[model samples]
Target chain A: MAGRSVVDAGAPLRDRVAETQPSPASVIATEIKGLVARGDRDQARERFGALVAVLQRRALRVAFQYLRNPDDADEAVQDAFVKVFMHIEQYREDLSFDVWFMRILVNASLDRLKARNRQQRFIAPAPDDDERPVEQVPAAEASSERRLLARERWEQVTRAVANLPDRQRLVFTLSQVDQRTPAEIAAATGMSAATVRVHLFRALRKLRGVLGEQA
Target chain B: MNRREEPDPTLADALDAYRAAAWAEVDAHFDERALESQRQRILQKVAQAGQPARVLAFPGTTTSLRPAAGISRRWISAAAAAGLLVGLVTGQLLHVLPGDAWVHRVAPRAAQPYPSGRLTLIPAVATTDADNALLDAIDVAVTSRGASDLRAFDDLTFAYEPR
Candidate 1:
């Protein structure tokens, strides 16, 4: 009885529940289960391929954030997807599938990070070839000189954030860039709220000092 | 104790301005559609990969079960046939088979006598009879004394012939 629920591998259950009728994803998942039950490997493999295609982009982004290297990120994402497929019966429909999937991604990222740390391997950031100037606002009161200075200040802040200790850096990125709450960051990082707060405080102080010095 | 609650106007102004700036930056970065797409994709992968199915504690009605709902008569017939087959097979295998077949196939050691002169202490009184009162009393005494599986008196064969 445990680990048997109709879930669409093509889309999330939230979207399916929101639909007026049963979603195609649910139907597909049900069919996949039946195929699996009947020992129809070919059909399961085809469905699995479709599932991977649908999840690749989002998984890539999450992996990219954690691994900071495109190749490593891609590998991690693919591995996580494979793991999810292999252990599909462990999923619970009562919980949001995204949260569950993110849990997998986070765990995979942590494992990779730990392994790399053990090997003393440095993770390099992926190249952002599409980096462009901040879109300009016409009829703004601010002068071009002032805008340039602000942009420079932001750059300094970003650099300061990067230079923070790993814990501080992670807390700052999750809080500011990802807009996750302190509680959420605590949950993801497996740190106490007080610890997260301390990290945030240190990160902010370091950023202010760095940016203020640059100014 | 009621202390004077003096507002630090300078600190308040700085905090307000910082909050506004932070909000503006957050708003600039916000992408609802992107987040939704990510959520959808993650869910899809989870469902497809069967990750969600394993965590579910109970089997529920699926899309396939929905289609099967219309074939009531066929389902009844199939269920009856399956039940009959199982019942017949179980009865034949467990009870109707010959003793020799059971002894050879099921349990070869049924006729062998258990090793004698080793008394196992039963925790509670096993029977309600005046004749078994002695056994019950002995059981209580042995258990209370914490006597382990002690060997019975050697060279003495005691047999109880039931009436």
Candidate 2:
């Protein structure tokens, strides 16, 4: 159970949140909500920079894990942040803001993916640039032969993960990349806990098989 | 949600290494400077989204929208001048046509002393029987084409005039 707010009725909200489990990002979200509700949007925007700073790297990581393209990931993160600020009025303070935000980020990524699919039907895809980040990762490590082998394994794993069906990919990425639990994944994706667990098991089984094949 | 799923320690370790390796590459590429750039961009987008949309007052005629504002301006001025000239010509035609010519067309014959000192237009062929032949003649004359020349106007006779 993800209980967000524990009862501490004594201190002020901000003071109490300093040591609480609600993250700095969630606390910033709450403050921004108050600033927006009070019609102080300029101050809210000022506070929103802090929120973006707290969440930007994590958001980027989740997006890059999903998209594999840095540019698309950047765009997805930007769109999600803009949407969060635009619809800040609808946010509920009692629930976990991180979960709410991750849901928005996931939706934004899905929209970008759909748009890319439509665009690909008309334009012949270019040979993927040799300068891709995934291909460039293992070049910096110790032995030359070892680096080549490591690159091959990483490429194989990436391909295997990419080939998973959309739900499985989502479940696996949120679980593996974003470090979300089955319960959190259920909340973010609107799937039931049992469904999240089922998808998680299937994804893990397939990935393990891929690792076994490599071995 | 945060509880580590303890299904298999070896599998979890491998997956954790995988996750770590993936994020390490991310951190290598997207460094602090890159993250700051992204943060600034997100804040920029948020700021833009907060403001109300700018509405163009005259979308078509906006200077910014035009390919050649100077050329378009000259054309617009020329069009306005042409419109004004056409309007002036039409007004002049209307003014001149209704001058001495129209007065002669519908003017009364030398106002013979009306029974009262004031000018009066009396119906000529008064009838109690309700049929008005004179009115029928006037209607036909009014509806018929105007005389073809100025001489035609002079030849037009008013039946009510004294012979």
* Every candidate's chain B TM-score: 0.23, 0.34
lDDT of each: 0.52, 0.73
- In the range B10-56, model 2's lDDT, one tens digit per residue, is 45655755676677767776889998898888888887885799887
Note each model's CA RMSD in angstroms: 25.0, 13.5
| Local accuracy of candidate 1 as per-residue lDDT tens digits, A30-84 | 5555666677756775785555555455555555545655556655665566666
- Candidate 2 lDDT score relative to the true structure: 0.73
Candidate 2 backbone overlaps, count: 0
**lDDT for residue B33 in candidate 2, whole number 0-100:** 97
Clashing residue pairs found in predicted model 2: none
**Looking at candidate 2, what is the lDDT of residue A119?**
90
TM-score of model 1 vs. true structure: 0.38
